[model samples]
Target: MITGASSGIGRVAAMQLAERGWDVAVVGRNPGRTRDVAAAVSGTAFVADYNSLAEVRALATALLERYPRIDVLANNAGGLVGRRGRSVDGHEQTLQHNHLAPFLLTNLLLPRLVASDARVVNTASLANRGGTIRLDNLDGTGRAYLGGFPAYCNAKLATVLFTRELAKRSPVTAYSFHPGFVSTSFGHNSAFVRWGLSLLASRQISAEQGAQPLVQLASVDSLGAASGTYFDGLYPNGATARRAQDDNLAAQLWDTTARLVGLTDG
Candidate 1:
């Protein structure tokens, strides 16, 4: 299953997986676009708004009920909503859409994923290096912040923490990835960022290029040996921050996230 699979890197990855004879589940908010993308790959399309936890939960239930097992879960449905905003649940929009939604869905689907030896891949980012996780201010309230990218980075950092902690708790392998600076719609909301990225044409790669490593990570047997590792591009080996690998921090993040998302191990 791949979230944000209607376009960009997720879409490319979905096509690649389908070509390899995997039954792909493409997820996105736009039904028409998702259906078109799914048709191109002969995969199923699911539409769900990540901004709504209720919708996310409903989608997860439907997916688990419909599919016997999910061999892979790619939590790639995330973004920065430009200015500061709040979800229907009263949490920051980015935190809710980018982190909390995926967090909840992954946990709800864990049993099915585990039953299938599923590998989970989270689309993390280089932006993570610029931000810090404020446990006390998980909602990004009570603080004057910059624009979108910093908050986006914080969400990605949280993803890595979540992946690491999840790896510790289960036999299922989980990894975070920096898909490189690909030219995608992800930065289109910011004119300056978009222009800058455009200027760096030589540096930015296509979504197909970015998706290569993600597909390799999900399908390759060698990656099975390393759980909770961060991948840069297609290389299984890369330098992740020491803080990202902190078990103590990862555990704290797990507990806090579980509470925030209302998922206790009952």
Candidate 2:
């Protein structure tokens, strides 16, 4: 299952996976492009705007109904929205959409994932290198607007931290990777972001190239036991920071996230 599969790295990865005869599920916010991707890949398509928790829950239920076993849950639907905004769920836009929404969706589907002994590939980024996250107050508005790419970095950092946290308790394998600065519509909402990305076009790779690690992480038989690892593209990279390695912080973040998403039974 690939969220953000409507375009860029997600779409290319889905196509490649389909060509390899793997069952693919294309998910995205755009109805037209998602449908196109599903048709092109001959896979099922699910549409859920990440801006709404209700939609995320519904999407999870739909996926559970259609797919008895989800071998992979790629948390790939996220981007840096330039200006500060709130999601339909009332959380900050980038934090909620990029981090919290996926957090909720994955938990909602955790049972299916565990039943299948799934591999979860979180599309993380180097944006996390210098991020400052308020793990105690994950839904706090302050962290949501962590300034510029800091917001994105914090969310990406959370992605990595979540992987580490999940692996500690779940048998499911988890991996997070930086899909090398692939040229995508990630920050198309902001001209400033586009301009900044263009400056790095010399170092940027294609979306297909960026998707390689996700494909490998998903399909590699050798990595079936590989959990709580971060990759610099396809190769193993060091942790984002010492803070990301903080088990206490990770646990707190998980608890906070659970509470935010209404998972109170824990």
Per-model TM-score on C-alpha atoms: 0.94, 0.94
Please provide, for model 2 over 100-191, each residue's C-alpha lDDT reduced to its tens digit, 9 standing for 90 to 100: 98999999999999999998999888887866668555554554342346678788888888999999979998989999889877787776
Model 1 lDDT tens row, 1-266: 99999999999999999999999899999999999999999988899998788999999998998799888899999977777788887889888888899999999999999999989999887777765787778887866545566678788888888888889998789988899888888767765556666777889889999998789878887764478888887766466655776788888878887888889752
Per-candidate count of clashing residue pairs (backbone under 3 Å): 0, 0
Off by over 4 Å in 1: 195-199
Q: Candidate 1, after superposition: displacement of residue 140 in Å?
A: 1.7
